[model samples]
Target: MTTDAQAGPITLADVRAALADTDPSRTNAGALRKVLGRGSYATIQKHLDAIRAERAPAPPEAPGAVPAPPAEALHAIWGAAWAQAQVMTLARMERLSAERDTALALAAAQAQDVAGLAAEIDAQAAAAQDLADSQAQALAAAQGVALEATARADRQAQELAAARAEIERITAAAAQAAALAEREATIERQTLQAALERQIDKYTDLKAVVDHLKPMAG
Candidate 1:
């Protein structure tokens, strides 16, 4: 708690006055209490009530806090206050029907404005949630697409691997066939040469027979 001595040129009355300065707009009570400084909501409200009852002009509101009443709101409040005064004054003589109606209308309008602000806040929150939901959906879709692409790539890789294996098998079979053909060609050349040598020996044997027969004839 700040004492008057600790706070230079300030007093408890200053704090009360600061609390009095706050416009009683529909704001968070907790927030207002914090702004009032070193007090509870009841304390701040007591100060406000005292200021109003004592007919003192509240101090200017804190700079850059929650927006205080605008000119229009102040005017409206003044007009309503004036109407209320007139009704109170005239109540002894006659009913202030017009003033009552105007006050009721202004009150209704203010209530509608509060309601509208609440609705707008809710709408903005809903829009934010919708945007987040859409982004989440988009992320999920992207992940799904990525997963599908990965599966497709895996399938394609498998097929390519199978194709490469088939190619290797075919190339190996062709090499084996080429080697067999070369061996067969060599065997056929050796067999033909052996047959030619045998035929030459037969021809020599036939020539001996011919020589023997000629001698016998002579």
Candidate 2:
């Protein structure tokens, strides 16, 4: 009957009838609108306020004292307030959830960057170790070559010393043999001069005896 647009207007009797089965303490205007299916928010609120004013008790005789509304009107106000609070709370929860998702994405990206840097550091350390090993091997080979050269030099020095000693010994033996041959030649020349002087003296004595015998025979 309330949903009929051909009906003149929404009446207080219609609102009172709708409130009969519903608890105003736990419901909002939108849900009541669905049940009635006719009135706009302005029309519903005007009627709701009129009902609350009618239910409020008279002011007390005391000074500065206010009157309390009836239980039904109070519950209706609280119900509208509670509905607004629920809407605000849901919106805030949605914003907080979006911010949390963004933060999680940023943290994941930073972790990937850190992993890449660590890999680069490990590669550099491995390359440095390889270079050190190669240098050590080269130094060992150079030391081996230097040792062989030193040994060859020592052997050559020993051979040169031996050759010099042999040359000096041969020179000393040749000097001794030349001195002995000169002494034997001097002795043979003296013996030949003495034999020639004795032969001349014998010839002179034989000639004098023959001259004396020829003078006696004449």
Candidate 3:
């Protein structure tokens, strides 16, 4: 590397040496800037143009042909135009690279957001499932309680029916006993009346016999 501080001033020789060391396809002011380290871009370009003009094949001169005066200026102008075009190309490439990096970053961020949303949806679904399970359990418990209450009501109804049947049976038995006692009292009264009538007849017969005996004795 030939820096300006070490080489005193960036010259055509310095530009030539940098261009030789660099790949021919990548030979430009920017690449030369890294090797030379201390020249303005315009100055480096001017030296590079001079080097290209020197290497370009000169047209064969006719015998006693006069050298054109404006050819040097035209060569320098064309070299500057070419250098400007290369600089524009390099700038465009750098801009495109930066844009690609930005696009990649945005894509990564979008992926992360999608992942987070997926996780949240899964959590909500799990919560809904848990809520449904709890409601089902509560309904089952309520049904069990209702069935037990119904069973108790049925048992009470059966007991009440049995008690009513027992009351009916006792009433019927008491009615039958009262009817039998009434028949026995009527029979006893009829037998007492008959004995009284027989005694009266016996008394009458005895009085008649006594009267006949008194008359005979007189």
Candidate 4:
């Protein structure tokens, strides 16, 4: 016959006992407080909150839907995406290099043609000085075109490298977010399970008390 006031702390058992002694017509916080003796309103509210959380229904899953993927599944998805991106990047680099090599080969061929024109100019300088001057202008233009092509190839390579770095940064951020979400879900599930267990124990103790009193009443 320990009173709630003398007890170390208010427990689910104390709350159940107070509810049992309260008048059915006056089943309210005030009535329960009277039965609980020195237990404060806050103590009664804490147990009530626990009961509500325990009895709360679980959220229903979508029909035909699978449960959320685990952390490893998320990691695998990220890895697959990363691998695919790398493949595409490598292919792009290869194509760019091929185009650069083709441009360099074309430039080399044009320079060989210019060298043949120069030899002809030297052989017929007095008779075709004007023609040799025109060929000189053509050679300069070809050289300019070749330099421009080389610059373009360099720019493309730089751009490709920047794009790859951006993709890697985004992938890492996504993986980190997924890991954090999984951890939070795990913590929430554990907390809910613990609350449910406490609720079950409270009800079991209340039922035992009712059974013990039944024999005496009979």
Candidate 5:
């Protein structure tokens, strides 16, 4: 247990002074008990408590001079003021301690709130990153489709060029075949005319021979 010197108002030196002095406030209760040889320790403790209460914290010096009390009540008023001062001091200390604890608790709660906010920000950032990644993937797919479309268009252009070339080649062949047919028709007509002239010459020669033989018989 804590000693009275550590917890109470009076120090060891004060105890020694009280023991040496003849005054009531300075005198030791233990020695007084021996002198009286009658009261219990509990009685002594009660008297000590009274003295302590009388010596309690003081009030503010009454703000200024106000009204003076009657001489009969002066002593009572002074004692009452001293007792009030002691009570006020203890109350103010207790109040200040309570306020300090409240401030500390509030500070701790605010720190936790800050941590929660930071975690929320981190979660949001992760979600945003996921969204950004999805967007990037979609853009890449669109670009790939555009490239494929460009390649298909190029292939179609090449096919169209080849089709035009084939059409031109077929047209040239048709023209050449038409020209050859016209030349063959002209050659057939000339051969038929030469055969007709040879037949006509043979017929004229046979008629002349028959006429000469008849005139000689007559």
Candidate 6:
């Protein structure tokens, strides 16, 4: 927990402690900011977002569920409309051919009018084709956005996983180091005890020899 005059770097441990008593569903930016002092809403939000992102696993693909069209319902509606237009265009051509035949029996002026109507139909078809092309372009753009979102999610998952693995490795290494230190301390204690015991034995032997020599000298 490090802070400056106003705000500071919010650690993962600090965030966890702040939310320890709070309900998971109620843990929002405001709630976190209340417990974790000195950070702005954005700072709290950034830490909270990272916590959630790290905790969340990547969503699994639904089995047997078809991937949705890029444009979703809009694409389907437009596709159906385009298909209907093709059918109507064919029917309109048939009607125009019958009308042209009728005009041929009537006059040159009516035949000219039928030619105009055919031109209008061709223009409408071109407009419909243009609309379809625009929709296709829009769908492609949507697909690109979806792909980018997916890639971002995958990257986050991988980074979180790596972080967890590194933490575990550090923890295991610390435990091993601590155990080694305790063993070394125990060995040093035993060595000191053995040295002290040897000194005591030598002192006892010298005392006995000194006592025996004093009686002889006497």
Model 2: per-residue Cα lDDT over 158-213, one tens digit each: 88888778777777777766667667666666666666666666666677777878
Q: For each predicted model, how many residue pairs clash, with residues at least 3 apart or on different chains? A: 0, 0, 0, 0, 5, 0
List of clashing residue pairs for candidate 6: none
Stretches off by above 4 angstroms in model 5 are 1-75, 186-218
For each candidate, the alpha-carbon lDDT, in order, equals 0.77, 0.76, 0.83, 0.81, 0.74, 0.85
**How do the residues 1-218 of candidate 3 rate in per-residue lDDT, one tens digit apiece?**
75545668677787888888554445778879997777788888888878777776899977887677698898999999999999999999999999999999999999999999999999999999999999999999999999999999999889988988988887888777777777776776777767777777777777788887889999
Over 7-65, each residue of candidate 6 has an lDDT whose tens digit, in order, gives 54766677777888665455798878777665678867777777787677799977896
Worst 10 residues of 3 by lDDT: 21-30
Q: Which candidate is the best by TM-score?
A: 5
Model 1: residues with Cα > 4 Å off, grouped in runs: 1-111, 208-218
- Candidates 4 and 6 compared by TM-score, better number: 4
State the local distance difference test value for candidate 5: 0.74
Taking all chains together, the TM-score of candidate 1 against the true structure is 0.44
Query: Considering every candidate listed, which one attains the maximal lDDT?
Result: 6
Record all residue pairs in model 3 with backbone atoms less than 3 Å apart, i.e. clashing.
none
TM-score of 5: 0.50
Q: 1-218 in candidate 1: lDDT tens per residue? A: 77665345433474454546555443344665566545566655655555556665668987776767799989999999999998888884455687788889999999999999999999999999999999999999999999999999999999999999999999999999999999999999999999998999999899989988998899
User: Per-prediction TM-score, please?
Assistant: 0.44, 0.43, 0.44, 0.38, 0.50, 0.35
Write one digit per residue (lDDT tens) for candidate 4, span 28-131. Answer: 55666777676678877777566556556899977996788999989999999999999999999999999999999999999999999998888788668778
Question: What TM value does model 3 have?
Answer: 0.44
Ranking by lDDT: 6, 3, 4, 1, 2, 5
